[model samples]
Target: MRKLYCLISLLALIAILCTGAYCQSPRTANHQPALAASNDAQRTADAREGQRILMWAGWIIGAFFVACTLYLAVERRRVVASKDAELAGKSQELLIIQEQVNQTNEELMAINANLESIVEERTLKLSKVNCELDMFLYRSSHDLRRPVTTLMGLVEVSKLGFDENTAKYLFSKINDTAVHMDTMLEKFFMINTINHESTEIGEVNFEEILDSVQHSSLVHNYAEQVQFDVVVEPGIRIVADPQLITFILKNLIDNAIVFRCKDGKRQPVIRIEVRPVGNAVGISVHDNGIGIAEANLSEIFTLFYRGSEASKGNGLGLYVVRKAIEKLNGNITVSSRLNEFTCFHITLPPSANVQIQTEAAARPVLITA
Candidate 1:
């Protein structure tokens, strides 16, 4: 309807332009010269006037169409610009959403890495727990069961009829069995403690620790019979767990004492030496006692391993020693001569400084029997 109104208005403007052009006549420099012309010349003048009116009307219609075309082009330009702005706004929103997704992906990757680390740590702990459980089973089946069975047998024998001296002998045997069982129970507790406890490193005084072990019940009984020549470096600083080191030393020293030769040929001498070896400490525990055979050298550190058939120990001592040394990140080696002497050499990395002396007799400390 609007387009029809526009078309009608344009036609009315064209008609008005043609009427105005028809009313006005063309004028020349000569005033009445055209009136004096003949009949054919007057007709020619009238034709020229009509042609000029038609040209004027055509020019006016062309100008109106040009204006309408320019207005339509401007409106089209405005619509295109508005659509471009809307498209640009949506594109910007998409970029922002993409950045947010990338940030979320990064956070998820970090969480996955943390979870993996946690799983690895827990797996290690579980594996260690399983190994300790196996050890417990071995002890219950072998060490604990034997001593208990022997104790029960001895108690049953005590009830049998016998003379006074025989009864005394049976009582003594029963007492020894009971003591042995008690010792087994103590060792079981120690093993459990060592298994579960965490190692604590600190400054270690080898001489002080050695002195304390000598006074302890583990070796005090043989103090007079066996001489302990402790030769600790004058100022050796060792960083290790005192309990772990003490356990290792105590077992080795007790083992040396228990395996002393029965022959009364030479005095039992257990010499202990502590010195620096580069970044580690070198320890020598040598005893002049019944020695181990070459065949048992490789198996001495194993659980419940005894080098000699006549070994009175429950066989857990050396096992505990090995475990403690491993915890301290140390290594031990043994060299022995039958019926002569047995020597244990150990190297332990202590996280501290050591005072090394080139001279062997700088400050010699000797304890003789």
Candidate 2:
């Protein structure tokens, strides 16, 4: 635009200079008047033509400058509009990202809350276990020390030179105490194995397992007055850990024999039954025994819990049995009458797809006749 203005100014200056030169040209004193007049007129006509041409050139240049300015304005508006649209798009994207971040934070907070609840529950359980362990230690120490002390005193008395019959009675007492201590220690070892050792799962033959347990119990003095009976469903087969199952059955059966009714009106009897329940296996050990009191039923499975003076047990048998059942993802329920009978029913999942559910330690149940 500046260049166009400068060009118009230069053309005007040249026209003015030409006019002045023409006027200043020396009028020849010797020239004829008519010829000089004619030359002045021609010179004026040429100057007029040149002035018109300069004016037209200036107008054309100005029009071009106007068109260029309008073009530049339109292009600038288009560029500004494009930039505004792009900025708006970026802002929308940022808002979406912010929303997503907020949602994620809320979800994380929920998860943290749930985790805190779970941790609190676990901590309470651990505290209870610790307390139980302390009790176990005290009881174990007392029980173990009493038998040892008794044996030592008996030995010292025998050293004083007793007669034959007296010596024989002393020997018998020593043997009984020693046997009791040995049984207690064996039970402790079995508990340790249940906790640390893994058992293999296989197809178990219940008839064979039951027969073996029955024979072993009889040999071990469980047959003095009680008769054992076994009944298994025909073609009954199960997939499970054989050792664990046998241990459970043995413990229950032994408990039955140890706590049998002593009235002797009719011989005490233990009945074992195995049958299938749905997709799982069901085994029941029922015995006519001096049954558990209702008040003490729930406490039976607790470690070292003794219900009465007649309980000639270390109190680990039922506890170990419960633990074994838990390992197999099974459940046990005890139903008993005060003097009639006591029965333990166990339900076990199939070995192929056993799903272990987290459960608190087992507590026994009592049933009235």
Candidate 3:
């Protein structure tokens, strides 16, 4: 393009120089006749006309070249604009990709934080379970050994010759020890059953259950002296593991009988009430027993927690009660005042068609001595 411009410029310059030469050549000529001068003047006039034509041609060519340059410049600007638009689009895409990457990173960070929190929570739960298991094992071994050792000693004493009355007394003591051991073993069995067995949820006849419990060996002897007042809501059934409910009731009733005040100030009475509390069956076992002291309330439900010196239990009754209640997705709360009365309230939730309760939990209690 530069070469073309230079060529056009050169041609214009040549046209201007040729016009000047033609206009001066007539002046440089020697003095001549009028006719010759006139002829020279005529040649000059023709040269001037030719110069004008060349000049117009140069001007036209220059104008055409300028138009072409303007067109080329416009085309160059359009190409640059197209390239700028494409680059701008790519930059926008890059920015969007960066934003997406940032969002992904943020999500990953949040997930990581949540996982950390979950792991920490699980670790704490595992630690607590381990501690409880250890405590359970230690206490269970000691309790089992104590009864076995006593029975062994009793057997050795029986081997020694004794009077008939002494023999009877020894045998009776032996029988009592054996019964206590059996009760402890049964409690252990229940514990194992509750822990290992999956819940077999079904409809339970509360009335039939009450009849059986009242007739059981554990309650029959106590019934002779202690009054049992049982009030069950009519036509009400419980949807739960019957065995678990039976276990819970059996323990509570037994505790009511065993822990009764023997001072004879007030008659020993146990009131068992079953009624509906919201969507669940609420069972309350209240006894006018030598009730729990205010201080022992919190420890009563702990494994191997023996709240009273008069307690003949293996210290697993209330613990097993709580565990069984939890297995059935129930809640239990205890209220007691020393030498007055003790009340244990239990709420059992249905397994299906309703939400189960969180767990067995005691309320603010004045509990066992």
Most lDDT-accurate candidate: 3
Q: TM-score per candidate, in order?
A: 0.60, 0.68, 0.74
Q: Which candidate leads in TM-score?
A: 3
For residues 1-369, could you state the per-residue lDDT of candidate 2 as single tens digits?
Answer: 456556655766676576557545654463777787787787687678666766665676566557666766777788889999899999899999999999999999999999998999999978977887798789889889989999999999999999999989999999889888987887777777887887777767666777677677333575556677776666555667788888898889878877888878767888887766776778899998989999988999989888977888789889989988988888999999988989999998765524222222333222211
TM-score of 1: 0.60
Candidate 2: worst-modelled 10 consecutive residues by lDDT? 360-369
Which stretches in model 3 have alpha-carbon errors above 4 Å? 1-103, 234-237, 349-369
Report every candidate's CA lDDT: 0.76, 0.78, 0.81
Candidate 1 colliding pairs:
none
Tens digits of per-residue lDDT for model 3 on 61-120? 678778878967987799999999999999999999999999999999999999999999
Enumerate residue pairs that collide in model 2.
none
Model 1: weakest 10-residue lDDT segment is 351-360
